[model samples]
Structures are given as C-alpha cells and as structure tokens.
Target: MHISEGVLAAPVLISGVAAAAAGCSVGLRKMDFDKTPRVAVMASTFFVASLIHVPIGPSSIHLILTGLVGIILGWASFPAILVALLLQSILFQFGGLTTLGVNCFAMAFPALLCYLIFSKLINGKNQSLAVIAGFLAGFCGVMLAVIIIAAALAISGEQFITVARLILIAHLPVMIIEGLIVTTIVVFLRRAKPELLKGVV
Candidate 1:
C-alpha cells in the first residue's frame, strides 16, 4: 500500500512533500492535545490494522482502516498515519522514507476526506447512507491513492506504464474487498457503538 522511493520522479516527490507538510500543519492545529488518549488508541489501531492482510491476486491487500481512523480521530489522522507509516517503514520496510510524503498523502488525505464526508452522513439521520458512504470512502480512497501512484509512476519513466497498468488492474479486487470490510465495520459500529461515531466514545 506504500509507494517506494524511485517510483516517482523528483518533481512528484517534491510536490508531495510540500503537500504533506501543509497537511501535517493543518492536521496539527486541529488536533486536540487534551484527547491524547483517544489519539493513542487510534494510533494503535492504525498501526495494527496494516498487519492484517488479505490476498488479492499477485499482490496482497491490507486493511488500512483509514475510514475508521478518520471517523474517530478527525484531522488528527495526519500525524497518526505519519507515525504509523514511519514505524512500518523502519520496522518492516513496507514503504521507504524517500517516498514517505507521497505515501502519506495517498493514505492520509483520504482519511481526512472520510472524516468530512462521514460526519455529514451520520448527522443527517441517514444511518444507511453513513454506512454506505463509509464503505465507498474506503473503496474510493484506495483507487485515488492508486491513481496518484500511477500518475507518479507514469511521469517517472515511460517504461513504468506497464507497472501502472498492473497496479490499476491488481487493485480492482482489493477495492471490492475494502468496500465490504469497510461497510461491515461501519454498520457494526453504528449499531453497537454509536458513541464512537459522535466522536465521544
């Protein structure tokens, strides 16, 4: 799920880095230091979530839980994802430091968007829509990330288009799997732990 170094050209990497810095700054200001405990819990969730994988064709897929992270933590997701990805990169080499910013934007931006979109869904007296939106958020989120990666790869080298094609093809089943998992989780949470959605539990 992480984009490695040398996969993107210098320009893309630089632009992603700048966007990451801006995102982190905005996310930081919105972070509530007083609720460090919740942040810690979500950080742990985000950390452990990536370890559980589902096989999808040649490449395996993992549960990013970006939707869950966003629903619970809001804008604080930026640092949470940053910390988790850094740990993964250092400990497991799931991604590299050189491509960290691009990967960060790939994952964290969707998380932020999930927060915005889901909040409206849940508050509008449409539980089903909220669940569906949460599901689609996770589904669409990965595609968006893949698109970014593919575009970055395309610009990196003309030879990379085949790799991009493989990526786009490989992720279709993963997207479906993500949608199912995300929907199931959201529905379960809505019925069993509604407080979590309201940002209280």
Candidate 2:
C-alpha cells in the first residue's frame, strides 16, 4: 500500500528516507553481480504487481509478492523495491516521488523480516517445513506491512485509527492469496530448482 505523498509529516518522511537509504546501501553492497538479472526480474514483478490495485482508504492494496522476493533475494529487496517504486511513481503516478522513501520502506522492511524469519525453513531439507515457512512468510509479510502502514497513519492523526483497522481488515483476502501463491512456488522450487534457495540469508 502506498501512502499518498502529503499524508505524512516531515519527521516521519525524513526518518523513512534515512532508514531506506541505509538499507539500500547494504543491499547494494551485498548484491551478487551474477544475480543482477534476478534482481531486475523481481523488481519488474513488484512493479507490475502493484499496478493492478483494489481501492481502499487513502490508497490501494495489491499483491506485493515481496515475501517471495525477499526469500530469494535476501537484503537485496531494498534496492529492488526502490527501483520498482521509482518507476511506478514516474510512469503511472501511483505513488508520488515525495513519498517514495516511506512507501519503499513500508514494503521492504517486511520483506527483510520475512527473509530473516523464514530463510532457514525455506532452505531446510524438510520440504513440508519449507512450504509452511513459505506460507508464513507471504502471510506475515503483508500483515506486518499492514501494521506498519497503520502505525504510520496513526502517527499522523488519531482519526486514522479507524482507517488503519479498515485497511488491515480489507487486506485479509490478499494475505491468504499471497500465502498460497508463495507456498506453491516454494514447493515447486524445492522440487525442481532447489539451488535457488541456497546461500539465502
């Protein structure tokens, strides 16, 4: 979910930019040259996925697939999300340039969290456990992002409390859909392309 540019206060926006900048720097440094194409592909996926949005409160909701990206790309999701968000802002104006940092952070932080929490299970030898982890990653990633968006809104106004709750409730379907999508992908990869899960941090 992309918060429109003018909704956030200056302090919140500044903090978002700083945090995103640091994460992007680390992601860039840790990036494998050989995986650049993979990064591009994920970035494109994120870019395209966010375009088909279902309107909600002040913004809209869509399938991020960010958990899948994080499990595969690790910390590199920061830069990947940043690039996608940048293009979305420029091409479609879905999210404004001024709000880019917060929007990117909103998506990328949950991705990092999913990576840390699920990487081991997804990379584990037990296929069942791996699939479960995949489901949780996809489910939790959206849940966390919803929480973050709500908190960001709550920071701006107490009136946003109801809006936040509504947004989370509205996204329930998306969470389940993403969970199944990620679980299936993980199962298939474990069977046909296990190498993709190797060396994930």
Best by lDDT: 2
Off by over 4 Å in 2: 49-61, 199-201
lDDT of each: 0.76, 0.82
lDDT of 2 by residue, 65-171 (tens): 76887787788889988888888778887888778888889888999989988989998988789989999999988888888888888887878789888988987
Candidate 2 residue pairs in backbone clash: none
| Model 2 weakest lDDT span, ten residues long | 48-57
Total clashes for model 1: 0
- Positional deviation of 50 in candidate 2, in angstroms? 4.1
